[model samples]
Target: MFYICDERGVWPRRQRRPSDCSSQLVRVKLIGEVLAPFFLVAAFEPIGLWFTAPIAFAIYLSFLKHQHRTILYSIYFAFTANLLILYWSGAYVGVLPWVALSLLQTLYFLPIGILARFSNNIPLLISSILVMEEVKARFPFGGFSWTRIAFSQINSPLASIVTIGGVLSLSFATLLLAYLLITKKKSVAYVLLSLSILPSLVSVIQDSSEEKSLRFTAIQGGTPSKGLDFNSRAMGVLNMHLAESYRSVKGDEDLIIWPENAIDIDPLENAIVREKINELIKRTNVPLLGGAVLSEGPTNAAMLFREDGSIGSIYIKRYLTPFGEYIPLRSISEFLSPYAERVDDFEPGQVLKIHSVSGSKVSSIICFEIINDGIVREAARSSGLMVVHTNSATFAGTAEGDQQLAITRLRALEHNREIVSISTTGPSAIITARGEVIKSLKDGEIGSLSGEALILLKISISDYLGGFAPVITLIISLLWALSSMRRKDNN
Candidate 1:
């Protein structure tokens, strides 16, 4: 239907491929597309009995390209990969929630794919990918910001960039590397690759010394067990965690933390619970931070109790899960209807609360807040450490619980902050500022995991300040390196 002129200026009309040939290519394309997502999901291989991060990046890359079916392929790949992450933890039942998350999260990549089609300029493409990904992550239900590209480098050296751009900078760097590798130039590729490996180099040296970390302990008392009243279950949970805190509390232990809902009763209404926490603080002689129900009808707030038993600061969960937290009215209005209850479902904790006690400043993020990177970044800029108090009971004691913990581990590295992830159903992990898991509680156990969180003072080079952004400024220095190539091209 179209005509083309050759070098000789002769024109020829083009003919369409045969119907059978087109059909065959479509069939081949479909098969490959289906296989891509499946392989993407299986990337998270088992470590001992649990999963690790290799597959996470694999699924993420499967969505990074530009193609006719790339969006569809990315969605299939992302959703299926999430499904596998959920399935690997338990059975079909365990995967149900994540299946829903993936279905929604696949939308996060839609705008990215659409944007890539409009232009092919690599720099523009990179910016569009990062900004659009960030934007979609904020829409259609508070944006599922989990599985960010920067998170993939937590165990790797690329983590150092956090000291410069914060985690947002790492995400941008990740896209830069992805763009460079996807291209065909050797010199340009070498420069990008060298920059990509810088974060890991910084992390290896920092994880060794921990500089001047303050010793801290996190306690997990497990979830509400079967046949137990909320009050007694609360007592049982309280006793187990109390025992752990006591063990870790030397005259030197700086702070102590407990997982979300560990104190099951609404702390505002229960004077006895408040007194018990105060007693524990008095005995341990350290400030305590943990999850407590501060309000009735779903206040879902985390209260910071100073050693004197006075409330220091409160961080209410700003984001709540749909259906899990409150049911929406129609599908969309559930967040708004009298039944939707978006603004009122829980009194939204409006400000980031940083509690200063003893020597260090800490921010307590209740469950679901860590899924939002902006909250952690804002908290990090204002505070020294980030404390996550989460209860994974609703996850039904599966590896999905571990996946959540692992994601937080990465956040610690991305922001270069010491992280204490205290979960009600085990996996109470102590992660250094570089995102390495120092110690953790055994999953599915009804006990606590305690460690010297205060003593870990290796302020990352990124943390020590003057981060890799200066290195990025080396773009000018690269002009010298490229001069040789430029001269050859000129000749």
Candidate 2:
């Protein structure tokens, strides 16, 4: 839309208009820019075209020569990708909050595009994007660590290295492969191609130790109602879970776990509820770890019942759900949704709680806390087994529960520990150290999973050095950008 004035073209009549072909070319480029990130969205869950991220990035990189165009393209891509993948966010809450969230997250890409414009090196460009993802995963609250590029490759060939370096490692490997392929430098490409086969190599050399297994039941008690009002009848919700417990055919199960908010009323305070649970314990003849909303201001806690019928240590949920568990800036946020006012602020647990259920030591992660790096890593280091107690009742029909299950599968691989993820409304499963779902239940299915898992006492490298990989990558990216800028100045 800009024009150059020729010396003879001083008058408007003498000036020439740009060609229509140039305008048409701009339109074509803009269309491709928009489509690039659209394909990236398809690479995530539900549709799950896992290979599109690199292609999308390549298209994005093509725009870097024009800085203004690159910035606009990056924003458009980020916003579109987030909006598509996170459409489920608006399922419970309205569209406004969801759109706001997507827009806020898109801003993370703005600086990334600016930094990427400074460097043409494959490694630097790849590292900058990785660092951008890391920042988005850790800010403005406890962080929303959903739809990470690594999560898309749960079933990928390179999933094995997760034990050595965690999810960020998987992301790094994927980006590296993309870069090598694009460069088409046979030597570098061959090196990366060979490196990609190492997961199979590591699998051959890794310990295939056969440990004794412990039996556990992951209970999925259906909600009273399906949507946001699923827990409207709180006591009825408790009764439904209690009914599901009695209905469960107990085999030689060592322990039973219920999802978060299985018991809306605190069994500890109410003698009647306590007596009801005690009766179930006597009938099942097994200890249980189930979630409860305790009343000295409604703390989300895991109530552990001992085999001796005594109430064991209550493990409180450390990381509470940001808006759902407690609405931050309630006064300002109330405008976003009427449900904001409906949310009561629950206090975050002071300590990470790992308890012994019928002799097997299991760490409890309530709801979305399983997505947190520090919390999950701490639990994996200390405990032999891990359990995620979640209430997916709010997001029953959406892909949210399935996405959460995907995350749980990655966690099982990352920690190399057996995990029992029990949900309020289905997608419950018992996953092994190798990330296989031994047994699983579908969404909204009123069922319980009884399976055995080998208790892995060994911890992973990620357990020892949590979040360090991303931090190191971020520093390297900054240095690479600075070095590139310096070279340009010297020229």
Candidate 3:
């Protein structure tokens, strides 16, 4: 809309040369590819700028559409984003493990890039991303789901979509909105935007249902020190939890929970520790659920202590952290991490256990299990309340604790249940079914959070359909790919 006058004065404006347009397009793509990851990282903790997620994905998808060298650029974007998001993975260990883990995850993005290069079908691109996320979460020694985009949207209105189809649904909606934004499909984008708010409205209507409530206390006993040696003084960790429990419990709570690895010593094998826990339960006159490492099976488990000073239901951790709980490739892993050799391969539990406390069913998942979609969904299906036992002391000074707390909040929303998420050196919190934090303790603080938690037996649509969403997305992606190939052949 402007006149161009070069050597010839007062001349009419002319169209830009094809080469000039091509060069300008290339620059735009490069800029987007380089800057998108930073914005994506900002969307997650410890920055937690949730509104930036759509902007980040819009730029990323624009770069992907009809772009050459798509695979390389996609890898660059993924690696940069993952490296920042998972920096805590090697905070206590070293750089080798962190870099290696990030690279492994980055490989999953190659297919998305390749698919984008061939087809501009928005559904195909969105489905491919969801399928890759699901595959990455289950393969290569139980995949890490911490990098999923939906985890960063907890503070956004889009988060409410999780109640309909868990994290996968929210992720799909986010990508769709991003694609629409970049493609200038403003009309449809506005419609989807309006629909996204509907879930929140529905959630408010659902909350009016009357439900049973229980008084609970979550103890966050600060670790003796930060790093890999946080549990070196096993008794010190146990004593700190005991001291906090005694000082905080008001003798009126129905249940008390402790963080994972709080009792690093085997309470079953150690008579002293077992007797101490029993005495605490007896004195409190309340049911106690605490995590322990059993020496017999070398299993990481949550043991329930009854008010009568006897052990009750025991829920073993089904998902164990790789390289932390068990070494996958002993020789290679040891080379990558010096502390790898010191890590004992703990046995994974085959069963999911729900504890019954004062007529309410409670589900418990320990530490890294929070990221496993299937485990959390299955647990939420049967229980009214959720308890997360975690120990964030290993990556204490880093953003790991805050990131994990954010993930826990998302889970609370995914299932309509109140949660008690406790960590050893931690960002412990008592979260409501709406993903609101009723009470919390700061990192590296020795304290306890006591609150009233509702036992809502209502199962969310997400709890029922979360596991199936990925399979459905994968099927849709395959069908789209086949249809595109047929269209090309007909042409």
Best by lDDT: 3
lDDT (0 to 1) per candidate: 0.59, 0.76, 0.84
Task: Please provide, for model 1 over 337-409, each residue's C-alpha lDDT reduced to its tens digit, 9 standing for 90 to 100.
Answer: 3323423355566787777756667788887777675676666667777788887765544565666776687
**Model 3 Cα shift for residue 264 (angstroms):** 1.2
Q: What ranges in model 1 sit over 4 Å off? A: 1-33, 42-71, 85-100, 112-127, 172-184, 197-213, 226-236, 243-252, 282-286, 321-323, 326-344, 454-491
lDDT tens digits, residues 1-491, model 3? 22233342221233333332445545565677688999899989999998777788877766665345678878988999999999999887889999999999899999988977776555566678888878888888998888898899899877888887778777776776776666666665785687588777777766667468889889998878889998899999999999999999999999999989998899878999989898898888988999999996799999898998778898999899988899999999998888899999999999999999999899999999999988998889889899999999999989999999999999999898889999998899999988999899998888999998988887777766667866664675568547756665211
lDDT of 3 at 339: 88
TM-score of predicted model 1?
0.71
Model 1 CA lDDT for position 375: 70
Write down the TM-score of every candidate. 0.71, 0.88, 0.91
Per residue, candidate 2 scores C-alpha lDDT tens digits across 403-480 of 788888889888888899999997888888878888899988988988776777777766656778557546755675
- Pairs that collide in candidate 3 are none
Candidate 2 least-lDDT 10 residues = 5-14
The list of candidate 2 runs beyond 4 A from truth reads 1-32, 65-68, 117-122, 199-210, 475-491
In model 2, state the lDDT of residue 36.
84
Count the clashes in each prediction.
27, 0, 0
